[model samples]
Target: MTAELDTPILDNHLHLDPDHGRGIDAVEDFARAGGTHLLVVNKPSWMLEDVGDDEAVFRAVFETTIDAVERASEVLPGRAWPVLGVHPALISKLTGRGYTPPEARDIMQAGLDVAAEYVADGPALALKSGRPHYDVGDPIWEASNDVMKHAFELGAETGSAVQLHTESGQDFTEVAEWAEERGLPAKRVVKHYSEGRLDGPTASVLADRDELEIAAEEAEPFLMETDFIDDPDRPGAVLGPKTVPRRVEWMREEGYDDAIRTAHVETPAAVYGIDLEATL
Candidate 1:
């Protein structure tokens, strides 16, 4: 399919919160307007407001993730897919509230169990966690590595794609190291590109790596995203809506058609494990 067709353009990263003024319908409208495919992401804690105990909070978050996916699947059908995870800061906050790491892990497992019930066998799964700016040798970094390894294991076992949101250059290195250590399949790790001050440059660099890897290994797809958050007050917001087209042109200018196609279309389908071939 050509780029000009009203064919589906895959959206690699999207955050949806019904309570936050945008939900499935809003995302659908946006995608329909742009003629794109929408992959909706729902974080567990976004549903919780004043969760009291750590265990209770964990339960709430876990249920929210499952419920979000289940609801989205019903509401959006072929247009939407779900990604679930706990942000690192949220996990830390839960810990401060007396939730142990083991407890948190159990909660995540419970959510996965629920997810398996809803999605078909071998459904694509995405993880939403950030790498913090800290020393690689730090205990927290080690802990992050453990979490990513566990995520990879979960994806490999379920045949799900693992998507990561790394905050700093350090986070990228850490994820690469984690993937290398466990022999994580490149297809399982889909890195996101957000449109923020830090993320833009970092994403550009990552996209370059993705191109080089694709040239060398002809491996599984590496995902890219507009990752735009709309805010009337921000100058970058315009770029948010225009992200896909702009990036496509940018890639064309750079003589990176493969990267452009992957960023705007192909990688998204691969990341969500969608069968666009049949649909298009």
Candidate 2:
């Protein structure tokens, strides 16, 4: 049973790409399970998914995400939003048969341009960009880092908070510094799947009850996530859509209502620059 909290916890991050995965009723399941809002990122990691090799075509996925989330929101009003951009892990996939560094970089920049426009002009609440995966060796890391820096510039220019997805345990201070150097405030960042502080707030995925407690103690006003892949084969891969509410129940059992209220409610509201508090 989903915990009946007066204030529904908002999942800071999750991957519910329209075509990559997730059912039509994904938003409803999250809502019924006590999730009030989610930042669904479209991990457009490959061309095999019918995206083709064109940069414009790849960037169109962000627009499609807006449409998809809108459709979901019809079933659960204002419950779903998008966080779209180039994920570094998807670089190789985006490259396709004619993989070239310069070509891929230009294509990614195009995607970031689209992301910035949506973030400022469309319903996209934020942007997500990161190295394709952890330390893909120095050569790969340097190139990806340069591409990600452009993303940071977009985040800074558009005043959109960037949700980072680098490898776990990597010092994100440099990531934050990159944004800050580009004129974006470091605080306007959310480190996804973080274990400790880097320079901004962090969010957790699949942490157990005890782990969650330790995380909260380590960082005040952080966030929680399920990273719910919504894939049938790996159903509830990290945690299900209902994960946050279940964790909230655990916190309550341990008498940690304050932590729940902050991470699940107030903090998200402030970070996303929208109202997500106590809609219950």
Candidate 3:
């Protein structure tokens, strides 16, 4: 059964794939589990279909994400904000299409330029960008960093939060420096899929008991997420849609009410600059 939560319960990073996955059905699961809010991120372009040199093609991906979120808002008691951008994995796809690393990075940056317009136009509240989680050569790695920097710039320019999908086992010191230089606060730079090891950017730690406990103790001002890809083939690959509210219920049972408020209500509101309390 779902917990009767009074405060907001947010999943900071999630995707809703209508074509391949449960789509709005997943959002219903989250709401039934007592989740109140979501940061619905766009899936990688390649996941939807093969993309080429056209930067404007990303608009379809962003619009698809926004459509999912719009449908989700109809089912949710609280709210769902779309977070759009070029996924770092797109670099690999572009390079595979016979583009050099620098060319691929340019394409990714141009896509972020499109995404920034969405944020500026008030549909999206945050941008998503990060390097590949797996190992790559130095040149490709540098190109990815360049793309990340451009995203930070867009965040700063548009006054939007940025959720980064990155490799595991990082302190995010370099990312913090980049945000600082670009005028985006470290608090607004979220490290998605974090493992509670970061010291700078806001950690959107996975919704696991151990990860939450560690982030509570070590990472000040952290958030929680299921990172639910919503892909049917990989059911529960990262985590499921109901994981966040279930974990919040676990925290409530453990009497960590303050942590729940901070992670679910306060931190997200402050980072995304939204009145989440109003959603209730």
Candidate 4:
């Protein structure tokens, strides 16, 4: 249904778990649904078999994402880029293992440094960082913010975009402030799993009809994503990989061609500094 439209359908955040899930077949599913591009982000370090104490543990996670992106790109119409970093939830894991809040934050920052190296060395296009979505005490929360700030610094140094996964319901103006203060443009910071609000950093609105309508009504360019975890056990726990392209097909049928172009073409290119049209 979506193939008739030449517009790109880029999923802003996706995870491909080759070891325990559909792996590249998931990418094929997205392709069949008319998805053109993806940002295959790294899963959390704890998802790996070994959640080691050292910051180097994240390297394996990033490498797995890189491999997944390489495989998915083969099936995508546009491209699949890697987005690597230590998941903000890692602080909880570290603290559970007897590390203090500040220590965990330092470890997360170091892990992001590794991710930044991958971006600079050409395996990844962006960095992912955010505080835990659930509530926590003041110290842990503050520490998580520091870790996110370090990610912003890395983004500034490496010239890569940053994707965030914070708790929902409020404007992310504070996050935007942090990004700008670290020398990374607020526009380059994407709020993944967003609800189509423009009162924050760049939005990667979830591919829901109501949310897409809100974003389209705003007439502001924003990216779309499914946040598909690709977990076989929890099938479609977030949204399915096909969600974005299917939503795009719906948008086109509804005569939202301008929104389609803005989201799938212009906004992604602007945020990631990639030429989606040229890549195609």
For model 3, the run of ten residues with the poorest summed lDDT = 48-57
Residue pairs in candidate 3 whose N, alpha carbon or C atoms collide under 3 angstroms: none
Which tens-of-lDDT digit does each residue in 1-280 have in candidate 2? 7667477667777776566467556677877776666778765645224443455665567667777777766765347779877777666654555666556666677777778888999789888877765445565567677777888899878888888777776367777788889977776678777663434434543446766787667546677887777676687777777777678877888888788877767667667776765333
For model 2, the superposed segments whose C-alpha errors exceed 4 Å read 18-20, 45-48, 51-53, 94-96, 196-201, 204-207, 278-280
Question: How does each model score on lDDT?
Answer: 0.47, 0.70, 0.88, 0.88
lDDT of 4: 0.88
Alpha carbon deviation, residue 115, candidate 4 (Å): 0.1
Task: Give the CA lDDT, 0 to 100, for residue 70 in model 2.
Answer: 76
Worst 10 residues of 1 by lDDT: 196-205
Candidate 3: tens digits of C-alpha lDDT, residues 128-150: 99999999999899999999999
Candidate 3 accuracy as lDDT: 0.88
Give each prediction's root-mean-square deviation over alpha carbons. 6.1, 2.6, 1.1, 1.1
Cα deviation of 140 in candidate 2 (Å)? 1.9
Q: Kindly list the per-residue Cα lDDT of model 4 for residues 69-131, writing each as its tens digit.
A: 998898788789999988888899889989999999988888888889999999799999999
